[model samples]
Target: MNPIAANKAELIAIADAVAREKSIDRMIVIEAMEEAIQRAARARYGAENDIRAKIDPRGGDLRLWRVLEVVEEPEDYFKQISLVDAKERESDVKLGDFIVDPLPPIEFGRIAAQAAKQVIVTKVRDAERERQYDEYKDRQGEIITGLVKRVEFGHIVVDLGRAEGVIRRDQQIPREVLRVGDRVRSLITLVRRENRGPQIFCSRAHPDFMKKLFAQEVPEIYDGVIEIKACARDPGSRAKIGVLSHDSSIDPVGACVGMRGSRVQAVVQELAGEKIDIIPWSPETATFVVNALQPAQVSKVVIDEEDTRIEVVVPDDQLSLAIGRRGQNVRLAGQLTGHQIDIMTEAAESEKRQKEFVERSELFEKELELDETLAQLLVAEGFTSLEEVAYVEADELASIEGLDEDVAAELQSRAVEALERRESGYRDARRALGVEDALSEIPGLTEEMLVRLGSKGIKTLDDLADLSTDELIGKGDKRREIPAGLLASFGISQDDGNAIIMAARQHWFADEVTDEATEA
Candidate 1:
């Protein structure tokens, strides 16, 4: 059969048009068409033949060849040829080189032409998808607008001019109705390539979408005079953004808010009226946190940095506002600032203070056997722990509200007796638990720390070596976070936890190296 060739000018014109339309290289389209033509040619020849098609770029001349690689011996008939046979065709053919045998032109059959068309379409579509993915992957976090093409399953397929993106159901604002042909704006959250094609996933409810909206509306933000430090969203309801300004003249929050809420209102309209709080971010976490709970007026903020938590005290009238409806406000604030926020009213703080005072008063009453009035007096005078009482001078105790000099002497005696009794119990327990003296050699590991360690079954150096840093200086039973109180209790820094654990693990590591060397 004669090889079926299309018109040279027509083939070149089709490739150039397809390349322009698909936003892919013209050469890629030509290569794909060549592959399709090759497949059709292989169908007319035998499937067992190794076929390839080439189109001349200068003249658009199509040629077909059966490709055979030169080898020691001809491996099957289709793909490999003996070196001696290859040498007959070319005087100095190499063993690994391919020899091209020109085949007769293929005639266009109905089935063969359809097969060629299918291959071309498939490759062109694949190249189009790859181009779209590469183009949009860098556009991740950018805001783009598109017409709603259709909804499949729960995803909204958006026809973004040359390409399509999917806005998944969860990513859409909750209960915000959408319809086909509706114009929608979204942030490109993810672009992933899979076997079928590249998928561009979009999100309308993402916090970044709000950020991009602000950037578009506010000149200071877009021009880098102001920055959005952190953003959190309770999509379709409320959101918080922490902003900072490099220029002293620019108030970041005011810049985002615009004069008379013009700038922010534009963004709010796009977000389907999502309530947004624009806060000025601060380098001091307490100041940032205080600002994050906006409109509610935070009266005080206590931060525990190791636990990455902030306790926010607001006025009783502002309590509901600070927490928002269903605690959404504080929760989003926590997410934005990377801190666990606990919101409380001023009355609640006062109640907690009273409850703590009562507890400490009970501790003094139970531990020191002092009178009820005297225990209350000691607690009111700012003495909490028994150690404070035991360590203070007799004259210092006398200066308390109720105690006379003789009463102070008696109190000091009882305080020392109480501590000695507590320690004597710890000493007996330490000996019974078989805690080694070597553990005391660790710096900052007090006798009390050793006793606590012994109680937790970490009495020996090997036992300590097996413990993680979280177990040593962390009070976190869940989430494995280090709490400030635990760090302060040991008077150790965050890095010191790892250092102490490693100090115990030194022998273990040394033994491992020794065994490895011996094996070598």
Candidate 2:
């Protein structure tokens, strides 16, 4: 068959069309076509030697060059031309130069055409994958909204604008129901490269959902006027957000709450109805901590500087509220406030006789040469009982700011002297109530045990001391992770727990009644 004339115009137009359709450079298509044509021509029958093909755009001609050597050895048989053969083609020719011979019509069989087509498809696919990877690799930690494509094996696949994302089972709220084609918003947790496509990891159960909600609903937060300083959450159950305002005129808490609680309510709805608490951020540890534990008023805040702990006390009615159903409130509050918060009820305080000492704290502060703030700090650091502080070394107190060695020494001496004198006072107070031997008569506790307990500030037999085996032994499943077996070793039982708690309450009432009678 005769060779088809080179259609240069058709070749250039096809290259441009392919480049535009495939989103590739026109020069790449031109190079691919040249490779296809050269491979086809070189593989034609009886032309197995090395043959190079070139297209002349000016004249629209396809030229073929056959390379051959002049050496007798012909190391490369296909490319060698003997001296005699070279002279036959050209009377005056060099021995070492390659010969150029014209090639016959070049065409490809079915197998060669299939191989060329496959090469083009593979090259275009690789280019597309690289382009997609470049577009999405930097969008980490941002929120993206997309349509739910389908669910596969408990994982939700979402169709993002330029790519797809997978919401793994663990990143979804437990028992939450979703449907196909529904729109969902999630945080982009990770972006990964795969052979087939870009793998994006998304989450709806992240604690940052609270912060993202505020950013969407609150104008102040959206505009950078208010910043979400920190957040702690239990995902679908509850969340606490700490917000600070750059502009004093705008209140971060009020902004998060919105008008009549619209903003927070909207966020709660989006989170499968999770409860949210918005607390104002504070630079001061004491004030920030108090605000962090909201809906539960703190009667006193003790800062334990040495241990980085803060003990918060609430009234009897607010104990359950402060701790939430299973200590969730205090746990999240502690995480948000960056402190270890210990919550206790008023009943516990009365049993420990902490109230009596709590009242006389001011007087002790004065006698001990400590400010009220410093005294509170000392109490917060596990030195709740006055006797503990009385025995503290002067150097130890001096280690704390504002308490010099001389002042700590003087305070220790005075507190010890007062403890000696107050021993008789306590005995007299107990005797006047007619139950002077009540504590010593308890089933398993000895005098030494009672004293050790008192030193830890467990002076009374109220609910705090009267804890039942289950109440004391129940391991916290969610937050505290307490062990049940540990509380059994103590001489604490259900019947005695109730009786001791009642006796402690009665003693407290008796003391209050006598004080009133004496005043009258």
**Highest-scoring model, lDDT:** 1
**What would the TM-scores of all predictions be?**
0.76, 0.58
Off by over 4 Å in 2: 1-106, 304-309, 349-520
Clashes by residue pair, model 1: 2-105, 3-105, 3-106, 4-106
The residue-level lDDT of candidate 2 at 421 comes to 64
Query: What is candidate 2's lDDT per residue for 1-520, written digit by digit as tens?
Result: 1112336666666666777776667666656666566666666644567777665543435666677878766676787978887888888887787788887655667776666556655666666566667777897777889999999999999988657898999999776788998999898888888998778899988877567777889888889999998899887888888889999888888888988999999999888888888888898888888888888887877787644578777898888888887889999989998778888776776565566556556656765656788766666554655577787766777677666888777767878876766665655544444333556566554444444344444454563345443444333222123444223334454555456445545767888999999999
User: What are the per-residue Cα lDDT tens digits for candidate 1 across 15-57?
Assistant: 8888898889988878988988888888888788889898877
Candidate 2 residue pairs in clash (backbone atoms < 3 Å): 69-79, 69-80, 69-81
Poorest lDDT segment (10 consecutive residues) of candidate 2: 472-481
What are the lDDT scores of the predictions, listed in order?
0.83, 0.71
